[model samples]
Target: MTKADLIESVYLKTGFSKKESAEIVELVFDLIKTTLEKGEKIKIAGFGNFVVKEKDSRRGRNPQTGDEIEISSRRILTFKPSQVLKGAINDSNA
Candidate 1:
């Protein structure tokens, strides 16, 4: 869902003011971002783990031109679902 949707849900569930809910959500997101920026992982017991992974430089082909190109390495954010979450999804699909 969108941020506004989340804020509204939080406000309704916690009886918090819209302003407070928004700020709380923003703070949580900022904390996650800052922690990931520092190359650390964030794990929620029943949800998943957020991690930053590194990609090595590699050669790639340009789709349009079919020419060889060098691709620079970069850091990417990744999420690994927890076993509980995976099981929930599988059960729902089944």
Candidate 2:
């Protein structure tokens, strides 16, 4: 869901004003972004973990042209869901 949808959910669940809900959601997102920017990880009790991983520059080949290219180094964010979350998702699908 989009940010607005999340804000709406917060509003409905918490009985918060729309403006207040938006502010709360924005603040939570900003905190997550700032933490990730520092290359740290976040772990929620039953949700999952958010990790930042770094990759070094590497050599790659072009698919069609058969030419070698250098892949740039970068940092990536990844999420690993907790077992509880995985079970919930599987149960819902079933």
TM-score of each: 0.94, 0.95
* Candidate 1 residue-wise lDDT, 24-59, digit = tens: 999999999999999999999999999999999999
- Please state the error at residue 44 of candidate 1 in Å: 0.9
Native-referenced Cα lDDT, model 1: 0.98
Clashes of each: 0, 0
The RMSD of every model to the true structure, in order and in angstroms, is 1.0, 0.8
lDDT of every predicted structure (CA atoms): 0.98, 0.98
Clashing pairs in 1: none
Best by TM-score: 2
Q: How well is each residue in 1-94 modelled by candidate 2, as lDDT tens digits?
A: 9999999999999999999999999999999999999999999978999999999999999999999999999999999999999999999999
TM-score of 1: 0.94
